[model samples]
Target: MHTEHDWISTPITADILRGALDLEHTAHGVLPHRLPAWARAQSTDGQLAMAEAQPSGVRLAFRTRATAVELDALPTKRVYVGAPPRPEGLYDLLVDGRPAGQASVSGGNTLTIDMTTGSAEHRPGPAGTLRFTELPDGAKDIEIWLPHNETTELVALRTDAPIEPVPDRGRKVWLHHGSSISHGSDAASPTTTWPALAASLGGVELINLGLAGSALLDPFTARTLRDTPADLISVKMGINVVNADLMRLRAFGPAVHGFLDTIREGHPTAPLLVVSPVLCPIHEDTPGPSAPDFSALGEGRLGFVAMGEPEETASGKLTLGVIRDELARIVKQRVAEDPNLYYLDGRDLYGEDDSAELPLPDQIHPDAATHRRMGERFAELAFTADGAFAGRGA
Candidate 1:
């Protein structure tokens, strides 16, 4: 109900954005990219392209006195073919580092994806305005977190008063890369994602390179890690590899070594932690190119099923268990020479006991509560005294 003339429009510049590697100028507006343009040009997969454009950790951060703020964005929401419609993605508003409010745009573009055939169709829709009103009266730091799952193009930012980009708070920057789990799947909102929550608890700035269905050990991705600046770095490996059936044990070992080598090239002494996949019961022993289970589609539930046989591991197929052992051994071997390199068994974050209480809703991704649990556990293990990221700074 706001009149356009009454609000002041602020240019959505790079200075106000955080956690995105690239900003793509689009026909409609600006789109944030987790991967750089050069890295994206190297891949032709629609999945990776879509994932990178989703802006898992991106946010608009500024200091403003405005009590009313509105953001006009065109979000590209995903619709799984034959599955129940998904809810509108939520935009979280944080005031002075605390959650203030949450809202969602009513309508936007839709990308209908057919998992069975790996096909996607896009249907354009009008942009929607998300308004947050009656914020704190005085000047305060504000952050608007973009939807972690949807591809959102920022059209405009309107505030009742002027806003300036928030200055750096001298917090350590943690760069993390992984698969869809790290990409904020099934999390209630962007700030509630495990990494986001962990970053908040640990008092660090986050640069999340967690690409969904696309965390294969690509050279470009490794190079992306190598090029980005960070005080602490972590790579949660194995889940995607096991679920995609992407490589064998023999290939995985070397590929991981190469990835670490690339990262070390840029951050030789930064605390680097290598995390194995969290315990996924279905893929703990079973190998897979996991597939969507539509059996519960009629009931409005979408689940995943393992497609590979358990016995395939004998032929060198990768499984979560095997990958964990391999990652532990690799980190153990490398730590002898590199004192800063560390390893964490992802099971330590979420294990059998935790799973019994908070099972993964889709049989792959953790639900919102599980994300909170994992985030707390991670902060306890990695950010506490004597932890891997202890004593780190910006």
Candidate 2:
């Protein structure tokens, strides 16, 4: 009944299975597909199906190899946490909930999980590749969990199986540019990034160009977007520009136009949406100031001043509102000639009403729950049949 090809089909190695498995969870944060109500009714042992036919909230793929592995993969699902949970970190490789290895996340975004040690912790370093080795000959599946305190991006995995290539089904590409918030700052996972979530909801591919603190309308970033391929595009501006106070009104206006001009060089007719900043009560119209804080180290305390927040912004100067108004005026002039171009008020993405319900913990980035809400709203407004910039070629 079973053919040899099936058994020897690259052994169904991990790399081959990358981006295929997803963890579907409920609003209550429980994996429902893994714990289907019907399955629970049928058996007392309720082991949910971690790998199923439907898309998962958590997905993984492979990246590269380390310490002699047959293959490597990336995680389709990426979980993002603002801070590490413990010094030991929180990435663990569990075989049926039994610890097979340990992982530690460090430097805020890097993870070092020991597949053999059964203990992991968070450390300080840059984000890097995750490696796995010494697999049992017949191991069928593996699961990675982001512990309660830490957040992680499932960057890559390794296996020996041949990967089934994803067919390019002519899905329209959605290119997005923004700041740390767009980079997933406080979101729960990579898939939960508003752009990623919205892309999934709207059945589009995503090219997330969100860079933390680097969205100051740099010429390089503009060129990068201009050269990248895409069927549709959007630039979420304002907040970063305002926060950084990178330019004055005259410079800002020309920069916005230039950014579009650069992108137009590559995507002349693509539907381009320019989004303003979302609601930030304290900083909406207020300027920033140099604020110092005391760091309570183990032995003693240390004083430090934040790098940004110039002295001129101490009294309601250089605010997001100013940037938004300027961006809106500049985009309006450009849209006259480019009917395909569009503008989306950031308020439509996240408004004062929503902010009341989901306050920004840092007065900047939205938390995981808020990210979900923003993604849902964005899809509803921007992807609807009669939406302002809908039906453009993907």
Candidate 3:
């Protein structure tokens, strides 16, 4: 007698799929009711708390059934990060733990994973689509690794499923914006970014807009958010603005207002959150040049200091603290009319306690461990059922 395996067109259930496509929900009535499809089983227990301060690695794995194989399938996989470095290798497309392909790392800093037929190499460019082909028939598991050193964000995923798209069963969508810190920097994988982790814990979709050196309340960014669809929204300000001294109070306030206004155009009643910056001793009260000190490290060492002369602060140049204070003030004013608006102090996400435990190797960005801590705090404060922003909107 001969036995043979049969191909079945069984529908994939939410329980069987893993990795970033999994959905979670922390609170019941928050704004955006869908989390990123890519956030699945993370290291964080549902508790979503932080204790460490250095960078830690995150690995996300999921299995899916393939009915057939094709040469031209544009599968969409989006990974968000806080300031992804230029030529940064953050995505590794693997099949059966073997290299399927790797994302490009270029001179410009942006976190994106797009797969195409090419040699296994890391290239760089803006955040966008990743294509994969020649998949082995049957059930295959795909793994996505996020940055290990810096924070990261995960936005969305799209694939050509012969079946109708499954309705999202997670919590509300969580939109976030910030500088490179929110972008993936020195991360080992795309799924391990802190924002991606937090979204997993909170159970919400993520719309990450953490631009490198460009989170300075740009009209284009605000317009992007305004046009995009979301249920919950957040803006992580400071750090970049202070380090770059991009604008003074005269312009920063109005610019922030305008930014929020544009977003409100799309999500008038959505829960909007405003976040400040994490702790950086060098930029605490000083400003300018957020670069690291390569010379200070003897070997295998990284050092960082606030750029520019110390006297710049005296001339009304911005500092991290200044930006935080202003952000708080702006949020307060907006909340008066927009009750759904909320504020989360950056220090709360990563404070002096964390700084003492996890000193910035370069005094500029947090390590992998710190990213985990930040993600936990964010999920706890922003996504918990009893959290501050919970139940504010249906």
**Highest TM-score model number:** 1
Candidate-wise lDDT, in order: 0.91, 0.55, 0.56
What is the C-alpha lDDT profile of model 1 across 1-394, one tens digit per residue?
A: 6764378899898999999999999988899999999999999988899999998989999999999999999999899877878878999999999999999987889999887677889999999999999898998999999999999999999999999989878899999999999999998899999999999999999999999988898899999999999999999999888778899999999999999999999999999999999989889988988888868654667888888888888999988999999999999999999999999999999999988998888889999999999899888899988889976743
Encode model 2's per-residue lDDT on 1-394: one tens digit a residue: 2222222122223333322222333222222121123322443321112122122222232222212232111222222232223233234453432346644443333444332342344444344344445545443335443322233333333344433433445778777777767756667654666876787677776656665555667665677677767777888886766656556666777888898898899889888888888887756756543122223222232222234444444443466777787778887888888988888888888888988899876567788898898888888878887664466434
**Can you give the TM-score per candidate against the true fold?**
0.97, 0.62, 0.63
For each of the candidates, give the backbone clash count.
0, 43, 61
Off by over 4 Å in 1: 1-5
Question: The CA-based lDDT of model 1 is what?
Answer: 0.91
Candidate 2's TM-score: 0.62
**Candidate 3's residue-wise lDDT over 143-256, tens digit each?**
444333322233333333332333345456666777667754444455446686677667665545555455667565677677666777888887777766677667778888
lDDT, model 3: 0.56
Pairwise TM-score winner, candidates 2 and 3:
3
> By summed lDDT, which 10 consecutive residues of candidate 2 come out lowest?
45-54
